[model samples]
Target: MASKQDTAAQGTPVSGGTASQHTTPPKPSADAEDAAKDKKPGTVSIDQDVEDKDHQLPPHPEPLPPQHPSFIHCMPPKNPAITKNKHSVFLAGSIEMGNAVQWQPHMVKRLHHLPITVCNPRRGHWNTSIIPAKDDMDFKTQVEWELKALDDVTVVCFFFDHNTRSPVTMLELGLLAEKHKVVVCCDKRFWKSGNIHIVCGKYGIPYCETFEGLVGLIMKELKKNDLDVDENGKLLSEPSSAD
Candidate 1:
């Protein structure tokens, strides 16, 4: 009964209206749908929460193997045969009784992986009360043992601890300086570092300021003598001859 224009103006459905006469709601965008999926209970997408497997970190590597111990020869009373084929190092340094640091054990540990012998003069059971005189047989024997070991070893390694005077070490340095087989390491704080440095420079001996540097210099000397090895104690391969 209502006119068509009046029915449309009053917001009422027109009589026998076609489907095309009404508006259709828009479809959700792809991004909105994805966001809705991620918001679902117990559901998480890679972009929203989970990290991609391709970008994940790698597993840790295995640790290196343990090193082998070197042959060590301590000073007199307990005579052990020296390894003839292996190179030897004589630890001649600050042994100011209770005053000096026990550096020999550390040095021996550093060179443990190498095929070498270490001549350690610091006795495990030294008679500290013995008078250091020619008349004292014990003193004479100890001094004689050091002298022979210093003379026989492949290299003489010296470390001047800053805490002690080490006059005997200085004397030993002077004795071996001209031999070109000596390597010296002196703490910068040592009282006589200047004198040691000058002597090393004059004799063309390798001088370093730290214990580790002394070890490196010793390795270099060994390498020069055909005992080739890397810093990690791995033996270096010999270069093949050209046909």
Candidate 2:
């Protein structure tokens, strides 16, 4: 049998009784205890679940895919599909053929995260020779599609480009002003800025001078009506009792 001094030197607990006797494990060192306490809170270890009961922390949510807004344009002779969305925006702005800036693409990019449909009037292939006559089937179809989309959408965003006259845009604004579903962005450089300003003021319509400001106003309107969505395309707020 080994001497008690030999057993102690080998770091084994010594027992005077039979070998069947059990020995208690040694306590952890002070340094080890302090190190454990110093560990960052909420740091999940391999042995611990992400949602540890002792920590009372929720599991980290997985990242959601990017959300893109649906777009509808006047062409291919289709009905206003924008009505399929919970909310829609009619891009009633300056599209003076080859003259006005292509602002629709920029607007669409900015509103990509929202769960709303964007109805664009600019045709993909416009025939300049097509006469705007009542008998012209193509012209009639385009006008009818725009009219229906304007009526079906929740908001009408009107942008008066400084480069073009935008007579049609002005007319559309007048038609929707009384309905109180229009927002205007009139560039100060626009020839008819004064008239647009006066009309917007008269109807108490929200109007802005910059493109960014226009987007902000539209977001505000959507949030006010609970029609806006989160980054994951989920509705930001629950529908009101009236809705």
Candidate 3:
């Protein structure tokens, strides 16, 4: 009984008024979409099935966790004549390089000539995820070595890279700032450098901007300790004319 004009008026799609044409629902935000797409733990996720094209197996070896390592315990073998001389120059700084560690070798390369040994924390076993109850040898070794290295070092150098969040390094600096011969090199762009600089000034802990400058300060410390560093940065039994 309805007229063509009536039917046309009722069925014709208007600007956001008629339901004749298919109207797509509003899309969700990225976060909402991700939440919906993610398979929460303990939930039945259709995507988890191996037959599902979306399901992918993890790598053969799971990645390791963050490590707070110690190197003082690991000493390389040397000839008896080498004279395993003075204690270590504890390298305390950022070691988190994701899958690999940095900072230690670079510092060692620079300070290798110094009479003191390098007490590097990164040189030891570095699996931090391992529980102590089942396997505590690594934990015990690092803790003991660090305690010894902390006390025995003639000088401690704290190097802060702007990219690293070094909470432990800060603690080490605070502990040794007034108690020991310590030097700090904090990049100006680092979030905590201002606080460190102020602390260094307040406590009279020598501070510098560059790693090379830290080396210069280390040279000065070596001089005070009756040792000398060469122009090429090799530790010398006595002063050289190059100085």
Candidate 4:
């Protein structure tokens, strides 16, 4: 048997010899030592493998939102009236067949709801006399009144029923359209197929068969204008791309 000191010396592994190889823990460098000394005692030191694994994960990006279209705001609280450049509608029809009694008042009411001034010279029976008289003075007077009504309106809403409309109403329409008012010719006649309807169609004027329908059509056109008038009754006209 070898002596105790000789056995111990022989058991130690040399550079060229193989024994039970034990790896020594890596020593801290001068900078690492300084960093370790400055750090808190329980601070975790991440290995290169751990750092690389953390960086390897794909980044989660923030989600994006979808896009949408804009809409017009509805009528405002105590909505202002339309501008002076707005087209006023003239209710033209007959006194009989209860056209004035039933429709004119309702039409006028609707106009009040809008930013428009409705002019109906034939609000009573007196104005209807012009339809039959055909007298030069009477016709001239009617013409002047009709023209005066059209002076401020950018458009005309003419209401004529087969039972009520006469030659005078026709003449009134001609003057309004000639003055370039956007003519809205409506007929609530129970029996329509007449010369008046043909004339309205030829002139390219829009007409509705019922009062409610007519109101809807007129409102649609007014919305296109998007105009606003001042509180002092000063009218401001906005440019409209739609006719």
Off by over 4 Å in 1: 1-70, 231-233, 237-243
Q: What does candidate 2's lDDT look like per residue over 188-228, in tens digits?
A: 66799888878887877887665544665666566655765
C-alpha positional error of residue 133 in candidate 3 after TM-score superposition, expressed in Å = 9.9
Candidate lDDT (C-alpha), each: 0.59, 0.57, 0.49, 0.39
Off by over 4 Å in 4: 1-87, 96-100, 123-142, 177-180, 183-192, 228-243
Off by over 4 Å in 2: 1-65, 69-76, 228-243
Ranking by lDDT: 1, 2, 3, 4
TM of each candidate vs. truth:
0.67, 0.65, 0.58, 0.46
Best by TM-score: 1
| Better candidate by TM-score, 1 or 4 | 1
Best of the two (3, 4) by lDDT = 3
Model 1, range 112-196, lDDT digits (tens) per residue? Answer: 5566667776654345457889999988988888888888777888888777799999999999989967887775568998888
Better of 1 and 2 by TM-score: 1
Residue pairs that clash (backbone atoms under 3 angstroms), model 3: 70-121, 71-120, 71-121, 113-235
Q: After superposition, how far is residue 76 of candidate 1 from its true place, in Å?
A: 2.8
Candidate 4 per-residue C-alpha lDDT over 1-243 given as tens digits, one digit per residue, 9 for 90 to 100: 101111111112112111122222223223334444554543433201111111111111112111111111111111212233244555565434232223444444334434454555542212233353446675566556666655644455655544543555566666655443443434334244355455556665555443344444455444444534332112355434323
lDDT of 3 by residue, 1-243 (tens): 101111111111112111122211123323223434653444332111122121111111112222212212222111111124443476677644221223444455445444455665543223445344525775566556665666767677877766668887888888887764777767575689889888887877777655545665666665566665553344555432221
